[model samples]
Target chain A: MGCVRRSERIVRLTRHLVDHPGTALSLTEMAEHYGVAKSSLSEDLAIIRSVFEQDGNGFLRTQLGANGGILFEVDVSTTREQEIMAEILAQLSDPQRILTGGYMFITDVLSQPQILRNVGKMFAKLFAKEEPDVILTVETKGIPLAVITSEYLNIPYVVARRDHNWSEGPSVSTNYVSSFDRRIQSMSLSRRSIVQGARVLILDDFMKAGGTIKGMIALMEEFSATVVGTGVFMATAEPSEKFISSYRSLVTLAHMDEMSGSVVVEPGNYFTERM
Target chain B: MGCVRRSERIVRLTRHLVDHPGTALSLTEMAEHYGVAKSSLSEDLAIIRSVFEQDGNGFLRTQLGANGGILFEVDVSTTREQEIMAEILAQLSDPQRILTGGYMFITDVLSQPQILRNVGKMFAKLFAKEEPDVILTVETKGIPLAVITSEYLNIPYVVARRDHNWSEGPSVSTNYVSSFDRRIQSMSLSRRSIVQGARVLILDDFMKAGGTIKGMIALMEEFSATVVGTGVFMATAEPSEKFISSYRSLVTLAHMDEMSGSVVVEPGNYFTERM
Candidate 1:
């Protein structure tokens, strides 16, 4: 540790910060790990932090003293966000992605590790202030998004299933109208999935009438939990009046016509409107 | 770029390598990015590679020649694998995790990001030789696992749903028996999810009679996908003759009694059996 090269120390420091996002670490302890002077460690941290900020990757937070420590939270910069938005818009522009119903095929896009990895960090930064204890998303499409977002937020995620499985133990059930056909459908969450009085964030792939999100909100109420926020990958622009309010979407489905099978999409409220 | 310090160069190089895992980049271009001499860049990469190898996180593979560039693949070290396995076994040993049916509750466990991150890399390493073009899994429990594994392998993942959603466009369907209740259940994948003759790796959270995996295998056939390998988080030991073979699990469910409400588990076949 005493004779470690400068480059060696920098690589290890970078890896550690990337891995333990949102966790604060003492600089003195880090210096001891590499047998370096405290001043040298601080200098290294400053260089890493400056690079991250300049690159728009994310910045590091360092505090002074015994209780104070250094922390790094991976972020989605404005440039990065625009890149993701462009990707989503470009993909949505393809008419073939439009499906039989209101559903547009996005499984391919969401399944890409890099896409999800970036989008997850975006959601994490967007909602990091909520400080929720857990994230909740109905199963199938939202699972991967929730998993990655939870990782960035450093929390566990619970998935509600359309049907109850006894193996998951007792569950709390709620019925809601389906956005697809307006049919009444019910979803359930395992009773043990969330603790009472916990803060929760709800996320999903798409929102048409907000029926599913409404149902999840009600389910959260049953557990005496607070719904800090509701997030969606995209939302239909036609349904200006949704079943529930107080939600944010990453992209706006400006138009989609089942009659002519046409679709138009734009960036969501999460993105700044271009002049 | 010319005045970049050694720490700055090292940090940027490390971040770039970690970001573009599995992608080959020319040393000459990388050297130009920093306006550094090729020799200096090589020294930086060697330092990064040594640290990663020493920490057992992963290693960098640098090939000589212009066509043959440098590549990095994030991997789960043997020590990391054992740590993940240990966590799985300890969590599975809890009596309260026992559910009404054969299902020992694992939703909470799988929801953790760090655990899934490591477990995903383990699956990636175990099946890297298969070089699957895509990873496939049924809905609900397996989505997160599939998503993580797909990322580690730098491949896409396709999920089969329990029911057909028309908005996803036309989909091919197949019926198979589920292990949960030995009930005949059906699943479907979007017609566009996978291409014909693609090498596929099937993954899941748990397997008992191996019925669900079998169903997935059948579903893959309809897609004209090649089943390269099957991987599960846990498998029941008593199912001496499973619905299918040729699968590797991360842990072994030595015993679970619904009537007695007891649960016992051990490390899976992937680990060397203790004498």
Candidate 2:
């Protein structure tokens, strides 16, 4: 390779740090890799560190000592994560996204990583005391957060499908009232999926009537599993007659009036009250 | 408050660090809060730093300058994040969780904080070059990831609902094949929701045939939105016919044989090849 300039060296070094995890590289090592002088490499690393910190991804880390080098840290904060989630929830709360079927468009919100991280952190912290053996949620909207939370807790998650498959030997079915559609729908889970007596943390994206959560709680009981705790991304505080009780919400939909262009949302009480 | 012990003081100090992001506290101040000596506090901080680093959450940063104190750097690596994601995929790939509907119980996997953090970083890195204006995905499974990615990119995400609501004016509808169900399903998006000519990134949880992806792409085109890139959490490499031509996958499902109790998955080529 031909000679690389100082700026190019900085970008390459930053990208390398991003690609590698935990391992730190010394100034001399980086200098040799880029065919640059140690002094020049030091300057380049300074610029790279500033840029990585500016990006909020936490990619470049510096250590001081004889064996010290540059390490990449991938951690992001709970609040920063929460800000992203609040934005998505804000979008989802838009009345325009609500369909006649009473379902809100959730794909955009669920697919994003920052929001998920914050939401997952919230779940992990809430359940930290419970120390559930597994996380549980009903398909398909609940799957994203449940999966992320399980990973954080270092536990497995099991999904309760809306319907049974031919491949599943046998399944237990239950009735759930749809909060959005306001209709009774059937939910099912394979008999062999969840381990009996496992402490399960139930999660969902949105809960209005709490029907699905109730159904899952019932199913867990049927499987001899304990419902340790319940969590939801968004919950409507209006509906008083919920199927499941004692659940935590990240954000609550306080009010929405499309005709008046009025919508109100606030961080749920869980943040302050939980700890 | 009564005098707190050294260990209690350390836990309280760490909690404070976790709560106050971007703010550093001096060792003297921390020691004063707990009524402990500066040297005792130093030892306590050392233990706190070790615990934080061991968790892979971040680091307890110390500075010796006049204005410097101790700060926590919540940094994680892309590789470590990816490793967590691979672990989640492995859990999701459990054959016992796959129901007859050809769906895996993945709700728990999506609800994790660390996984979401990694996912957000992945999208930020992927879209750093293009810097798309908005993220788009169809309802339900895709919402969590889309929300997380949008948060990292600091962009808004738009969800195309599967059906139209009365609040939304007129919606454009399209027919798409469901890869899991292997059936034709109708997908719809409100015309007023998306901005025309804006660059959009489409995201989803699983892609077998890419039919829904095509529908979203079409919906984007209808609004004159540009499809900058597409992404999915899991994609089946087989079934060559797909709705979208180019996309990135976090994990690839190579094969599934129920009778033989064989299911194989590996990290997607996207990680190894991309920056």
Candidate 3:
């Protein structure tokens, strides 16, 4: 390979780290790939790290161990996170998104790459130290959020299903009461979806009463997996008594008035979790 | 508010384009944001574009008009895509992934961020010219694939539900025959999920007979939307006569010996589409 300039190498390195978030890259390999000296590579990485931190994009972690080299950890600053939450709050407060039930239609926000990326970064940041082996979520709406969070964390995610299909083969099933209607429901996860003793972080787009999250925890238990932490994009505040008390939410739905068509939303525990 | 180095500008520019794929960026705003001259910004963009294309990460598009600017178009090369497909094929070929009813348990692969990102980039590349207004898919398995595709395309996606919930407000419903069991089933999308005359690309994790994609198309028509294209991560080769003739798939399951626990998989129309 031809020798590349520092500017070109930095751009490519930045792209590489961004693409493979939370993945460690060896200096020896990168140096050989770029046909540059190890010292030069280290200096270049330092510059990249400085820019990433100054821009508030993320942190470039370097471990001195033999297996460690460089890892990009996504970090969304509290101020920027608050700004994103405020924007989401405004979107949720739209009257048209109000349904007959207390549900706020946020499919639009969850589907937007820009919004989801930021939200995922926030979740990844909150659980950065958790070093989860995998991410977990129930099927349907939470898929996107879970995917994005795992993407940022550089881990795979597993989805538990409400309906058991014969195509999935043998599976473990668990029953949990629906917090919304207090009805008993069952969710299943394929035996192969998760390995034994894996640490998992639970993520969801919306949480009304935490029934689904509770079910995910129960399902994780079947795999002998440890629940490292839980995060949600939004949660209803009406149910002061949640099935699971230990969880973080990006936004809180304080009040929803169907007759008058009004809604109240505030930044969730995500803001206070750090404190 | 101060002068910035070319290396610094390029790093930030690359991160910006990669983060907001397929979204056009105004050079004026970017230049102002970077505190650089328009000429300098153009030069920086040119360098970034060359490196991106060389790395086979994506393409940086430049438009020159009142509403013109640079746009990042994610493009995974045939060679890179083949490597990704081969990796996925190996994973799927495992007998452990085989389940009853001839279904390959792919929740792990679809939930994998690295693999899903590549698959999503491939879909975005195949339909790059389609300029889909939105991406669509049925809930459960396909949600992650659809979300990743839309993320690469920098657009929002909608999920159709197998069953409707009052929390979604008004929705449009359609019934289609299941290609696997040849059974009739109903799927619905929120009324606001899609708008009139929108261009949509359907995405899914696996396609047996493409009944789900067909149902999605029918639902899109109710909203007066056009189905520009459809893509799937994997599709079975059985039932040679597919319900939909115009679609793309990454991997094809040519055969499966359930008793012997052997399987055959190869690149799908995704390879032939370019030809």
Candidate 4:
């Protein structure tokens, strides 16, 4: 087939693979669909898989056995996670999402389920060795991915609320400086929420100054729960001391030159280190 | 063995079975653990299985042939997803969570991974017939269960944000009156977020006036996507005319008498209805 025809076929196959995850299609089937030889289809798949891996979305797993074909598995690495996070931070850093008071429009970041799943999977892979008893996050945005990670690990999760909830038993409160507001706010968790002696993995959507993680660490300490690891979806590269040293981040925002509309995003260290 | 000894053996076996999900313990192994006869262990297992099934969690499927023993298979219908939802709604209706504001505290409701998993499993059963293409939810709280349900169904999900996101491209926005604040807010979705002809299932953590659901429906219409189903974790009975009709709820809050500290919660019709 011509180059143009091959490119079109690759795009069609990519869409099909994405649309039908876990199901593999044989080279013969692809060849039949494209009215091409099996050898031609193999070459096309090789090019498509290479492009897909380069794009950092996922990879195509090929099998040659009877009843085996090719399947697309979303194997996100720490570096890719960081790349995605940098992209997210770049989006957040955009003046459009920034409110007058310097608050980021986080509603978009919190709403996307696919992003949450990606982040959760990244965390699961990073902390797989930890074998945490549960995933924990503060109420609201972090709840989505915390729950997802917890599900991935087959563990329960608890959320810490910012305010005092009467329904919850006596809670342990700690002061944490909010990165968005730059003001110290009280974060609280019910004493009954965290299981004693349980290993907890803390996850958050965005961490600029790492104050929230600090407070969570304090709460976990109060409950005698060990903090197995910490994971964040995105972090800012500025204010070098803002992020804690031990934590893993999927993406780091290097900088965004608003004047030039130039946002630089790259894969983070976690992606490279984990996957 | 004496009756007390046999009872102790049964209790120990039951605990072991609960701890090891789906693993079948052979009679010889059980006898070795309890230092009892194989016949006695078999009898104890039979009794434990019967009691467990009576309690309605699941059954212990026992195979009598060689290399067979007792394996636990959870009975999906026995626990009655509706009963679980009612319990969750009752927990949410705590006056402590409501405080002075009419708005209920639901952040904790979204954080519980087990509850979210159960909710997802319930929705999977409810929408088993439809097999929705994507799970849809508005931002924040709804994202958790929506992610879980999407994972359960193995389908992609789209979230409608309250504001237009430039990164998401030109989004369609719909005005939704907030049930708690009574303020009209716009929920927007990128034009590219959802498939045009896909069947979408909308999910939310809580439904009071259902304004958000209505906005979601409008958003789906804009994309020319079919709204296959709508489900909520909890719904208030007070809201007679919600934003949409033909929606399903796991639990309905019938009443909460703050003065008496009495809360009335019941399973919604969605639990028993066919998908």
Candidate 5:
């Protein structure tokens, strides 16, 4: 404990903060682990915090006192957010990504670990102030985004399935009109997935007519849960009349030409107009 | 570039290495970023590497040369693996988790970022040497596991859907026998999901008769891809005759009592036998 190298303590501190996001750790525990006094540990955390905040990666909040510790909050700087959105827009602009319908193939982008982590950080930051008890999204495309966001938020995520499997036990199902085809479709959530009266945040990969989001909100109501906020990676500019009154999107598909196979995307409300 | 503190360089090095895993960065670049000479940067990396390796969280591999620098490789130590498996086993042992079909409720655990990250690192390490170009899994349960594994391996993941959506554009579908119900089920993958002759690593949350994994392998064949390795979080001890013989699991359900609603699980091959 007496001879711990300065570099060694810094690496351990950074790794600990990275691994356990949103958790407040007491200086006493950290000091003991690093084999340093509380005063020296505070200095090390100060340097790490300054570097993290200056770089726009995240911030370390320290609460002074015997019980007060530190918490790591991940945030995306305006510049980083723009860079990420631009990269996503560029990726989604490929003509080959266009499918039979107006849908673009975003599975590749969603599947990339680095891209998913970055986007997740962006969304987590946007909703950082919200005390969401649980993250909710309907299967299956939104699963990754929701899971990653839940990770950063230090919360559990519940996925509503398009079809109910008996293995999920008793579940509550709700029918909502599919905005895409104006057809009625139902989504179900396991009864145990969420507790009643819990605050829920809805996360999805895309928002077309917002039908799925609406259905999810309804499903949440079945659990008597509160719908705190909703977020989507992309939303079609058309059908501006969304099912939900309010939500957030990272990018808006301003235009899509199936005949010519072209896509025009712009940053969503998260960037274009911040709250 | 000068006057960089040891703690400062260590923190940056850890953050950068964590962000970009499985990629080699040049020592020159690292030296420049840390504002220190190559020798000092090397010393910092050595300290970071030792702490990481000793802790069994992950390791940093250094390669000499202009092109080669350091690569972050994540691996769970034997003791850590046992602790994690034990914890999961306890959670899975919940009586209420027993589903109508002998399946245990694992959605909550899989969606938890901490649990998924740990399990993912284990799977990633088991297949670390495989050189997989992509990770594959069928929706919707396996999406989180696949995504996390892809994150650790630093590769893209492609999810095969139970039904083909026109929005996916051109896709290849195949019929495979479901081992559970002995029913024929069809799964499809977007043509763009994987490139021909690409090496693929399959990941799943649970393995029964291995029908889903087998179906994924067939789907890969349709795309002219190679199945390098397959990993699952849990597998049934019974059904000795699997669709595929070679695979790895983190835990195995040695026994389950549907009547009594009890389950017994043991650590998977990942811990029982050395590779």
Candidate 6:
């Protein structure tokens, strides 16, 4: 890189960590790339780590061993997380989001890349502690959220398709009832997508009765994968009892009135799960 | 963000710009955030900008107006881009990816976060010049690619679903013949996802005969949007002529023999589109 000055080195080092979140960068290799000594690189990393802490952007973790290296962990500050949730709550509370069946339309919110990115950061910050090997989500809306969360956590994600494409080779699928329509629908995942005994984190954009999430859990079972944790952008408060007993949501859709064009939202179980 | 020291301020400033690519950061606001003088902040930015140049990671452009400020433009170097494309070629040539009916099973590859991220960088670098207001992709496989590209370009994206979901409120749909099966199938997008007269770029994971891409262009027309460009991950060589005349692809699928598990791939029009 030929970045000699301390401030220059700090900027490059910080950019590397920022680009590859959750992935470890070999300190020895980094030193070589910067044409600096190991001790010098270590000092540079210290400055970068402290900057991360002071800014409350995230935290850095360094491991010592053969396969060990420096890693950047995504951690959203409590105040910033609250702000993100409040923003999402406001978007969801828009009366125009109320649909014909009182179903709150959220496609617009998820379509905005910035909102999707921030939402991913929140989910990643909350579920990263689980150390899931991979993320799993159903197709359609969940794909973007899963992709962003995977980016933040530096983990690979597999999307379970709404149907099995035979051209895709053999697939493992399970039928589940759709709470939104009260009908049976099948979801599928490629047989090679996940290996056996992998720790999995299931994420989705929204949940009502958790039928889709529950279906994903079952699909994970087919691969003999462990469901370490589950996260959702929002869930219905009325589904007090859901198909799945375990999951953390960022916001709760408390009430909706199509005729009056009213929608209500509150902090989800995320409050209880995280602080 | 009370970053006092020069290295510390550089680290935090670089982090914010890295987090928000294509979005301008006002120097006055950044100066206030770091509790530093405007002159000092500008000096710090110069250092950061030079570092970014030295690393060939990207470029920083500063605007001189009210709605203008410093912005990071994602630029993948020629050497790094070649490496990325070569890596993808090797991954795609794996005989195991040859599925039934000579179809390639790339779902597993699109699932990898690192590959997906790099692919996004390449596409963003190629199409960012179009300055498209929003990105468009179809449901299922194309969502992750679009989402990642959206992140790099710092623009919003909308996915057209394979079928209509009334829960999403009113939507616009068009029927197209599926290239894989030659069967008529419909794709849809929420009516409110895009505004009239917006510039759009269409992206997809794979294309054969370009039926779906054609559908997306048609849908854009329905919204009174202009199609600035179209990009695809891979396109089949056998089609020779596709439904869409103007589009770019990263890799060309030369041959796939399911019986012998022999697959071949060539670099796509990305080379011609770039240097």
Name the candidate that leads on TM-score.
Answer: 6
Number of colliding residue pairs in each model? 0, 49, 0, 8, 0, 0
Judge the docking of candidate 3 as incorrect, acceptable, medium or high.
medium
lDDT of 3 by residue, A1-275 (tens): 12237778887898989888988899999999989899988877887888889988899998677778898999877678778888888888888778766667778888888899888898898897988999988887888888888889999988888888676767899999877688999999877778899999999888888988999898998899999999998888877888896999999989888889988888898877663
Tell me chain A's TM-score in each of the predictions. 0.90, 0.66, 0.95, 0.64, 0.94, 0.95
Predicted structure 4: clash tally: 8
Evaluate all candidate structures by whole-model CA lDDT and list the values in order: 0.83, 0.67, 0.85, 0.68, 0.84, 0.87
TM-score per prediction, in order, is: 0.93, 0.58, 0.96, 0.57, 0.95, 0.97
**Candidate 1 whole-model C-alpha lDDT, 0 to 1:** 0.83
Cα distance off (Å), candidate 6, residue A74? 0.7
Distance from true position, residue A42, model 3, in Å? 1.1
Best by lDDT: 6
Better of 1 and 2 by lDDT: 1
lDDT of 4 by residue, B1-275 (tens): 26445544543455345423345678777678668788877666666555556545446777577768876543345356656666686676666764344445566666655566667767765774576788889876677778777654556677777776544556788887878778989988866567789999999977888888888988888889999999998888987877677788887878876566666677776756654
Report the poorest 10 consecutive residues by lDDT, candidate 2 chain B. Answer: B1-10
Global fold similarity of model 5 (TM-score): 0.95
RMSD of every candidate to native, in Å, equals: 3.0, 12.5, 2.2, 19.1, 2.2, 2.1
**Residue by residue across B1-275, what tens digits does model 3's lDDT show?**
12237767777888888888877899889888878799988877887888989878889887688878899999887689879988998888888777767777777777778998988888888897987999988887888888788888888988888888676878899999877778899998889888899999898888987787888888888999999988888888887878887888889999888799988888898888662
Per-residue alpha-carbon lDDT of candidate 6 for residues A121-176, written as tens digits (9 for 90 to 100): 98888888888999999987888889999999988998888978775788899989
Model 5: per-residue Cα lDDT over B1-275, one tens digit each: 12236667778789878766787878887778656699988877888899899888788987666668798998788888888888888888777777877777777878777788788888888888889999999888888888878877889998888888776778899988876688899999888888989999998888988988888888888999999998899888888778898888888988888898778887887777665
User: Model 1 over residues B1-275: C-alpha lDDT tens digits?
Assistant: 33247778778878767765666779888888878799988877888999989887777876576567887777777877777788878887998988764678888888987788778878887887787999999987888999888877778899998988776778999999876667778899889889999999999998888999999999888988899998999888987789996788888899888888788898888776321
Give the lDDT of residue B10 in candidate 2. Answer: 40
The whole-model C-alpha lDDT of candidate 6 against the native structure comes to 0.87
Model 3 misplaced regions, further than 4 Å? A1-4, A63-67, B1-4, B64-67
Output DockQ, candidate 6.
Answer: 0.74
Candidate 2 CAPRI level: incorrect
- Lowest-lDDT window of 10 residues in candidate 3 chain B? B1-10
Could you give the candidate ranking by lDDT, starting with the highest?
6, 3, 5, 1, 4, 2
Estimate, for each residue in B1-275, the C-alpha lDDT of model 6 and write its tens digit: 23337777788889988888898999888888778799988888888888788767888988678879999988888889889888889898899887767788887777788899899988998898899999999987888889999999988998888888877878999988879889889999989889999999999999999999999998998999999999999988987988998999999998888787889899998887643
List TM-scores of chain B, every candidate: 0.91, 0.68, 0.94, 0.69, 0.93, 0.95
Model 2 chain A worst lDDT window (10 residues): A1-10
Give the clashing pairs for model 4.
A77-A271, A78-A270, A78-A271, A79-A271, A79-A272, A81-A250, A82-A250, A82-A251
